[model samples]
Target: MDFPQQDPAHRTLTVVGGGVIGLTCALAAADAGWRVRVLDAGAGERASWVAGGMLGSLGEGIPGEEASLALSVDSVRRWPALVTRLDDPGVVTATDSLFVAASATDIEYLRHLADFVWADQPGTGAALQPVTGRDIRTLEPSLSSRLVGGYRAVGEWSVDNRRLLEALRATATTAGVELVSARVASLAELDDLGPDAQILLAAGLGTAALWPGADLHPAKGEILRLRRTRWSVPPPGHVVRARLHGRAVYLVPRADGVVVGATHYEAEGVADRVPQAGGVADLLADAIEVLPGLRTYELTEAAAGLRPCTADGLPLVARVDARTVVATGHGRNGIVLAPGTAERVLSILEGVEE
Candidate 1:
């Protein structure tokens, strides 16, 4: 299924994969006046489908990973402009995120992490403010009263993943980009496009099969989507990330309810997309502990997604061959890194380096 191309005279670019990363790059390329055609197998259990959609540059940062942190901070900063361009302002569900601790041990760990972020990582466009349990409750009363203390990441944002994908597809279509519902098994399949035609491989985990050097692996994660009931407590206005008993859980708000997730593990031997019973149980337990009100909500969906991970924990966004550019291995930060990936891929495609 291919859409009609309105512009035949412009330079053509073919993008493989239709996930957030591929779609985002396609949209950016089309806006740059390229005749973009995206080829995707339309798989339902993709990484983008099961994501929590938190653009957590600050909240998700690690102390030693300075390079990846810088990339995350840079990418998240581009989301505001990208959201405006998509014309779907409602896709942004939360503008801030709060990291809370449910136990005393967790509180100490949270404080150390917060201190590192606040003192060492300065001017990253995100400010970390240490808040007590009372402050967290005042900010979001829906959370559990058992929370001890945590940090409020004033700049983190969350989006409706499904909605964002739809908006990107719609806007890209309107921008004259073609969406083809077919998969390219390998780069050799696209050799007929000739030497000068540009080809971008943004196929998420599938990029490894197309290009042997993508060095991508699948990190499977399970997420639950809960629907709010009439009797349920009002959802938190800010994205809530809770640390309980040495485990981390987050509840991202939706218009209808909340998204609870996710437990990560290696997916090499496990090929199933079914949400593991143990994982789901753990997520539910942690979520209910963080926001006790979630017990009443209906579990509308439970599934697993395979996030494309790399050895170094950084996304691969470089040109591989003369006409081929690879953009995958985004790990868990694909949604957060889409804009920055698009920016860098476009620069590479246009032969411009920064």
Candidate 2:
């Protein structure tokens, strides 16, 4: 669909949601000479706040999901420039990630994933490297002595998401993007912005509430934060992902501790925001198996955040109408895909095909 060219002197955008995706897009639009305002409810508990912040384009890839994998690979490549533009180097925590397996079943799954990326998709496979148990332990000495193998995804970096959010907000403010603390219960409430104004629904789970046909549902995930104490062993030097007894878990290293996560389940038709005991238990148990020293670390936080997911696991970043754009359904890859999503939004506003 083609949009009548918008007047250059009157490009106005109102972004709903103050999370990573919303802020990232708002900043980009403002920099492009668009008058932009971000409306957020200022909720303290959000998926962006509780994310593990893994930019694992390769580690997170799966077989037969070529479209999403291709998007992730392309998005991860744009992360360096995004972070550089943010001017907050301290927000990045890890430059590499290690994927490990404890049992034979886990090893088989890991091997299958390795083959899928390395053999099936050569472009995406370049980020991955198959490694033995010794190599895994050699790289992250704090990892368990369990017998198995894994892969090392080079340049798959992670960031301090909390810091990143702050940097985005600060930078966006500096760029003249208005950050309004208000809840927009419906798209009708935004009609006061005038018909010529562009409205972007990038509110994660809240996007569906604002617009129909969004095809979005919430996937609740629980994650734990462990702070290193004097008695606790040092955190791993890299992001450590593991599959144990069919459960997927990851331990992302921090300067002072580690972030362990996560347990995924359908959150549709449910309103519970509290972290489930079983989910938290499984995350801790599996994290301990991967990094045994977590027993002595302080359990700083146990939080459940809702990821807005689409049925096919691919994000929706397209123009729904000439004055309306939708950029949600990022699922668990919102941070990894923020830069690319922003780029797509700009292209849509300019009526340029991507």
Query: lDDT of each prediction vs. the true structure?
Result: 0.87, 0.86
Q: Candidate 1 — which pairs collide?
A: none
- The residue ranges of model 1 lying beyond 4 angstroms of the native Cα positions read 1-9, 124-126
Candidate 2, residue 157: CA error in Å?
A: 1.1
TM-score of 2: 0.95
Query: 122-176, model 1: which lDDT tens digit per residue?
Result: 5743467788989998999888789988888887899999999999999999999
Over 220-282, each residue of candidate 2 has an lDDT whose tens digit, in order, gives 989999999999889988899898888789999888999998888897543656898999998
Deviation from truth (RMSD, Å), model 1: 4.0
- Cα deviation of 307, candidate 1, in Å: 0.8
